[model samples]
Target: MLDLERRLRGSKQRLLFIALASVCILIVLLNIGVLSDAPGIKSTIIKVPLRGDRPYDTIPFPTSDGSDFEGSYQPEDAHPIAGLMKEADEKWRKYEESRSKTFRETVAKYREKHGRHPPPGFKEWYKFARERNVHNIDDFEQIMDDLRPFWAIDPKVIRKMAAKLQENPDDGIAGIHIRDNKVVNLTNPSWRSETLAGLISRFVKYLPDMDIAVNRLDQSRVVVPFEDLQELLATEQGSRKMKSDARDGFTKNMGHFLNFEEPTGDWDNETNPEWFPYPGRQYMDIAKLACPPESPARNENLTVEDADALYKHQLGGLVTNFNLSTDLCTVGPAIQDQHGFLYSASSMIASKRLVPVFSECKVNVNNDILFPANMYILKDPRYVYDKTYDYEWEDKADTLIWRGVTSGGVQVEDNWQRMHRQRLVMLTNSTLMSDQEVKILTESFEEKGKYENFSHFEPSVFAKKHFDVGFTDAWGCIPGDCPFYKDIWTFKEAVTLSEQFKDKFLVDVDGHSFSGRWRAFLFSKSLGIKATIFREWHDSRLFAWRHFIPLDNRYDDLYSIMTYLIGTGFKTNPADNYANNNNVYVRKHDFEGKMIAMQGRNWAQRVLRDEDIEIYMLRLLLEYGRIIDDNRDEIGYSGDGSELDDFDKKHPMPESPPHLNWNTI
Candidate 1:
């Protein structure tokens, strides 16, 4: 029996040991899991590879092989005189260069002797001539002589060149025809009226007839009307009287205002103190307080409506009245006065709710006045007014004497005083409350009454909608201060929320103002959403359609009337399609359809036009010049190729067809 009992005890002990081991294992596993998931435990480090490459080198200039100036050569069969002149021009240039040294030396000596300055009266003229490299007086005279003959060249050639350059200047070589005293070699694959105008203005001095044929130097032989050249020049010169006619039309369209006035009595008699006892006297003082001398007695005879009207009129007058003593430039004093006026108006309005004396007086507190003033006072505690000014007495002695007479001053009693008296009477009339009831009713009401939540209360029904969307209504009476100011945020939120809700909400762009910043934020927050922003005041239709089309990703459908041009189909030459200005092809369609087609067509025309080409070339030159001007420090090259180096570094060589290698084909 003793042996069996001992065995049973051993078995029980083994079971207890097993249970202890299991608890230990579970605790260890729990700790390991917790520690592994801890935020502080970092897993591994990462190293990203960096890829570096060298910057690009400047491209070299292209070599010329008559191919560069291919289209510029006059055909052997056409214009025999032009071909002869070209040969003669080459010979003349060589001869002129050989003889130029002596002339240059003589001119330098004369300039040095003259002290390198123009003779006094010629300063302006000298400055103007020097800009065009006319350093010597003789060169200036030559330029003036060139301008004197208007019809020296065929106006046709001048117009054609202008039109061509207006279209695309890259198509041909630009040169001055010395014999004809005209500009030539305008080649544009595209042509536009504005481009033509620019060309005409550039070379208006040489009036060429409008029938010259404009040809592309390449394989494409594109030809266009010279009439475009003539009309463009005429329009540019304003010789067509468009400006004068426009002014006349504007004057005729203007609506005139009629002069009228109401009859009035003599000011002195009407304002006489005897006839009009009050005259300009206001019921409220300039400080917006009740007038001291008239207040208590005036309240007796004035009706509530009359008193309200008088107070409003006086408050408005005080606001509008300019104090000459204060410098108008000082906003500090003006803001102070504004705050004082607002406080007084609020106090009077609050008082009116009690007495009904100022019932009709409506002082509109708008959003701008509320938020800005609240923010100002919050930022600077000193903005609050605590003290009043004493303007009546000269000294303490005078004030004491004045107070002595007013000690028993008549007090203005009203119905508001009676209401307060009745509140106590009602409480007394109720059955006596136990301690628990008093705690529940009185203490609870004091802690959680309507007034306790005044801060969160929407000032009015209309204000609730605006406040929720982020706008204040404290200065509602002021222009640009009402809930309308929130139209921008409202519109943006509507559009954004609509997308998120999937057609549950829609913003009327026409109905509300849209702020760009808010719209940007909304669009950024939503993953697959876009909103159209429309300008409120200027060209609303254009702005709306443009914004909407872009948002819808319809790039091809949108068109700007300002940039519209005629299509390329009407041109006789197929190469004209490539001309910058000449390529606009106007098709028969609705305005909207025409606008869309005009976009790409105009771009093609501009490339083909000659005058457009010249302007574009000049623009490229200007851009290169600006770059050189801005980055003068980085300009560097090796050795004595430095004469033009310094000059070119300071003023980059103009980008031209020769320098640009523009035509790879």
Candidate 2:
């Protein structure tokens, strides 16, 4: 039994040992796997594989909120940060409220002071405040400070006042008092006299019944009678002198004023009913008395037949001197048969003769014949100065000077009237001639006749024809002789007139078109037909060599003519190369294209050129073009370069040919 018990104990001990060894081996394997795979595993031993497929070292632990530790972890909110954020929000809200309150108060205050709502800038309100009393920013600021605590006054009012005061310190004005009585007398003499007279007159005329008083000695007393005071004023030498000299040297000339006397009959008589009579009537009476006696009637001694003969002889002399033809006799019936004058009293004076005889009749006729001649006298010298004269006489004498002989025993003061009459006859004779006669006269005039008074004659007779040939030329009929009348002719009309004489006149010479003096004369006989054509078409020829030829060749001439035209206010379009070259042309991409081209060419040619003027003109063209383009749409025109482009394309750019120098272009 002991042996069997020993065997059982031994078997049990062995089984226990085997079990402990197996456990030890498992622990060792786990330790080796965990410790060997992971680096720096010091404190705790973990299993080789964690939950699911994650490695022990890679899997993160759960945080307190049951989220991933890396993502959920956050630092605690510090007291300083939270406190600062709250403080900022509170400050911002308070600031906004304060600003809004300030703005509202300012607006309200401005409205109250100005009697109307303030403008957005409070400009008027500030001006008013400155004008009242607020003089400087300090004053304004002080007022604002005083009113800041009050709800009634606006802070903005103070601010605006402060700003205005800062801007203008002496803007206010106070009513001034004159303490010294002598100060009034010491005032500007003319102003004081005028003011005093005006005051007295106004009281006399407007407030006749009202008492007039003055604090001369600072005592209030009933006013004296205005009439009595006026009498005293009239008697006072100083007052009378002032009144007499009121017109300066004007009233001193007694030739202009009239004297009047009290009425002899019952003053209120129905027939006369005169207080004194109109000053104008008194003037007429004075004028009648002042006028020199008329000469004794020399024509009265002669019979009507003798008078007719004398008149005919005088007319024949005038006609002969003026070179008037027999055709003028055809209108003889329309003319007057007066003993002295050429035209009848009722005759419609043609413009050709009106200028001359009007002056003659004005000076010659007495009151009996003056009735008809009075219609010819222009009331104002300005009318004669402006209407009757051309631009040539603008700088000449104010009154026209004339020199000539007179007939009909008419004693002339100045020979101006006679000379004026002669001029009229000459002008009339010139206009009334036939085409052939005109040609002959014009030739004769050019050849033998020296220019008498026609200082404004142009090289071409077109100007003469334009001024003369009244009924035949439509341009002559334009009111005021406006230059714009020529613009009324259509391009077609101009083209027709051009074509009519193109073969005869517009002949090409030396590869260039030119209308000589003779051809131009014939064309001008009608109505400036040749001038119109040349001005429109061949006008470009004036600047032809500018584009294709070197500027140096004719630069001086080109520059002079261009400057002249520009100075004279000639209209030039950039597209119209015929009227003007591309000198003033402007382009969008190249604003100073022409100037640049000019400068470049000048530099290439080694010519000293006016860069300033070239650049200035370029800038002017660019600016003008921009202004025109901007307003074109409103002006019922397309802003696109259509018109300019079309014209430009038709006139091709001159190409540089062969080995020619580019400096010319």
Candidate 3:
């Protein structure tokens, strides 16, 4: 009950079901005379739903994704973007305030979340964070969620499994070891190896001696089937009995350097025989197994329905529940063709069994543990944002700009048009997607409020006027199909990071994996319009609409979002003209755009800093340490923490001010 409650509390889902269920249970008991002195009482009261059942099968958000609408506005903001902003700001504020402030609270929070004491050396981990001035201490929940099922497997079995994985160089994974407070890099120097070593070195001395296996490839590796994953989790969490020899401290010198004392799993302890590996082909069907039985990605028909739902616009198609929007389980089937990973990841080496792997980023259903990307940590000049070389939102051109090679997944000539980078470029530069219409929020000349009209638009003209999107290179496609790409796409000269900074809106999308350029984009003085299927460590800290605009993976909401910020040029008597003439009424919302741009820039500085990266790594390592310990059930940091101050609790951080009152009147 406590574990379920903790999960629900952390989720955006409601907890009102508990109270409603309880009341209905009481009424039923009374009606049956189980709680009454009288014998024949057949009266009933309030009915309620069971915990197993949910009213809304899909995302609980009421606002439409603008997929089923073809009508005028209700004398109000035609787009739900304004309402989205309000809800986003409110959600972020509540989450920020809900973070545990002090040591006692942090320990209490850990217990509340896991229903167990903090692992041994947790105090040391806390001290390491406090000494380095770490802020968000209680946000290490992902580590637990990743490591929980492993608790069902014996610690010896886990150590042996990791050792075996490390032995298989063909597995495309590297070994990370910690000994006497130093990260031992036992692999050849590479970007991932160096970055992992550098990140761990920041506070490796604080972590216990343990062996870690990290995916060497850029792509995610492990993906347990939903049913199997559920069983693993339930078994792990249900068995709480401690071994007779279990102690309350970590084993001394537990890092075995690839030499496990126990026999290999193939002998006495056989590994899961169901670990199927897809070499290098389409893995969408295989990947879909990770989603729940009900998600759209799990079925062919549901996926088609989801695909059509992209703009099927009811109350105006706008993004809400940014997290849910990024969920790969629900999103993959809808926009699989638009993503490379779905159709063909460059390295499709994968597993359907549980394996601990530290990765840079992953989609929601993927089980890989996330770490800070090397692009952000390395501070490469190619991806860095230098304010001295950049323009402010007000000083820059009022246009959204994007420039990148086509690298989402391995693409081919036939599939080139479906890939995200290619599709985005096509949507802006040509009329491949839309013959002439662009979904937009504009003034309703008919009678009142803002109007959401699928207005006529020229992609080339819109690109020339409001966007600077193009492909710098046509790579990713098969060599045999490479010649056909140039026929379809007109490649432009590649621009530098500073060159892109000239635009007021930066568009970031997924590449072969998660875009590493997001951090750089956020640091700039421009509103970031990002659409991605991957989730990263910074996801919990970043709020869409408040910091950045979140776009759906399908990108059907593209024109609508663009028009909301930079209006259609339908100014002079739009009622009569209907924007049919070349008279583009170019109405701009510079204030709103600049507001979000500055907010994103400011927030990135505080939470996405290098120090914060180190803090997160340290916290993740601490949790990982407990999972691999022989006395995992017994060992824990036992401290009352009576001496901690509650400054944040007493006076919480002030929330961002309310939405600006636009003087439309």
Candidate 4:
């Protein structure tokens, strides 16, 4: 009996040992899997701030003329817009879940094929894929979701928002509210889910007159608790920083602001608002709450008058927010204030009280007349002083210089507007200018080899057209009378004309669109002889003789203008003016011309600075905010905060200065 009991006890001990071993092995395996999946969690979370500082403090709202609000305002009860964002959030969540599944599968496949585990995190996958020349490892479009957060205001919704308002219906202005950057509540320990209505309600408390606010709240929300997104955000941030640095370096070295590096960030892939890229970049570049530079930061508040005055400077227009206009008849009209002027960079409703810049077109979407309203006017990367050339009036080369491809339109027999370029190209010898060598840099070219059908004509076809009859058809002057290339030299190179700053005469002509190079030419310290009919953002501010020497749309006066400059009639004193009835306008001599060049440089330096732009943007926001508030009843916005509804009603837009009449030109 004793022997049998001892054997039974030994069997029980063996079974217990086996069970303990199995449990221990299971725990180890689970831990290994978790560690592999979330190797980047800590790094990613640490970079994100839980709460950010509030953008602005409560201040008295101002009217269009930059005065305190005297009109009565009744604050609306809090009606949360969080429900509006439900669909967006749900779609994002589903995508996150599906993305994780596919990502895991990809990682598994990589490991199985290599006979070893790949890098522990998906962020590393980018580098791995690049090393292997694999582009299809991940669905890039899925990563950058197209369904944005802000819903467009439809007629029904507009009525709802308008009905919510209590005061000022008939004369109120209606504009879109786009929260380019999502505001966050950093004080909360964890990201608290909030709605669009909730966010706007909180924002309007600081500026009550605001009619509507639109934006995607995802950036302000908590990140999904998944390894894949955490990895993507981290990777994207790193990649963006690297690319931004590279672009900054290029711009700085070249002494010009242009985004040469193609945007590789996920945001660039999304179909954003018309004014997304420009203001989005501006907001990100300067993350601080924009206000007047001289105002006290915390101790004192900026009065509406004070803020308005700062933007009243010549460059103040640059300070305004993106104007949102929906039609063409209401574009490019200016509203002056104590500080400067206000114009919509985007779409705004047609109102008699406001001015328009570019009238919107519903039928012909590609109307060459419409300015690329979405493009930011400030220098690309960031505004900076260009002291690269010291071209004194006497020392500058006598030749007139211009270089660019025919992008405005194809110079075919039917397209007369495009003929202007063909006329210029005829001057350049045919043997030197080949098919593939010089042609329009279209949307396809801008995308490099990724997209197609961006140009007006193929390179070979374009060359043939220009060489055959397009040039002759466009140039109205006879062979010898044409004066194709005397002192003027036009060529094509993969570079900006800033390289030719040493030339005495810089010819500024209208391209397929607005002349982006005009700003650069203004700073080149050389005499800019221009012939552009395209009205741009700063058209009202430009004085005929002061900013540049004007030439009529046709080149009829081209030879005569050149003769006045290079001939013995060229005088040094601004007082001694040279005249030619054949020329559209009288030319200023060397001394006065130098002063004008200096003035142009000074204006460019003052108005086009980084801080100048920021001030203009903030002031514009305040102005638009007031416009929304004053007309809320008409536009269907409701909700309350009368304490925040301060306005300036005394001084409206100041008496306008004599602006260059575009119609007459």
- Give all candidate RMSDs, comma-separated: 36.0, 43.1, 20.4, 33.0
What TM-score would each prediction reach against the true structure? 0.13, 0.14, 0.80, 0.33
- lDDT of each residue in 155-227, candidate 2, tens digit only: 2222222122111112110110111111121111222223322333311211111111111110011122223
Name the better of 1 and 4 by lDDT.
4
Residue ranges of candidate 4 with Cα displaced over 4 Å:
1-385, 410-418, 424-491, 568-588, 630-665
Question: 624 in model 4: Cα distance from truth in Å?
Answer: 2.6
Worst 10 residues of 1 by lDDT: 398-407
Candidate No. with top TM-score: 3
Cα lDDT of candidate 3 equals 0.68
How accurate locally, in lDDT, is each candidate? 0.22, 0.21, 0.68, 0.31
TM-score of 4: 0.33
> Roughly what TM-score does model 3 have, to 2 decimal places?
0.80
Instruction: Encode model 3's per-residue lDDT on 161-250: one tens digit a residue.
Output: 665565556667777767777875554235676777877887777777777777778788888789988998898778654343434467
Candidate 2: misplaced stretches above 4 Å? 1-432, 435-665
Kindly indicate the candidate among 2 and 4 with the higher TM-score. 4
Residues 1-665, candidate 4: write the lDDT tens digits: 99999999999999999999999898666666655756543221111213321101121222112223233222111111111122222332343344322334544444343222222123233233323323234223211221110111122332233222111222121223223223322111111112322333332322222223221111110112123333433543342211111110000111111112432122121211112121111111111112222332211354433433332211111111111111111111111110000110111122111011111111111111121122233234222225465455555665567665443332222332224454445433343343323211111223321212112222232223222211212123223233543333333344235556666667765444345567667766776766543444344333444545555333433433443344212234422222211111222224334433554554455444333323322222332332223221132111111221221122121222111111111
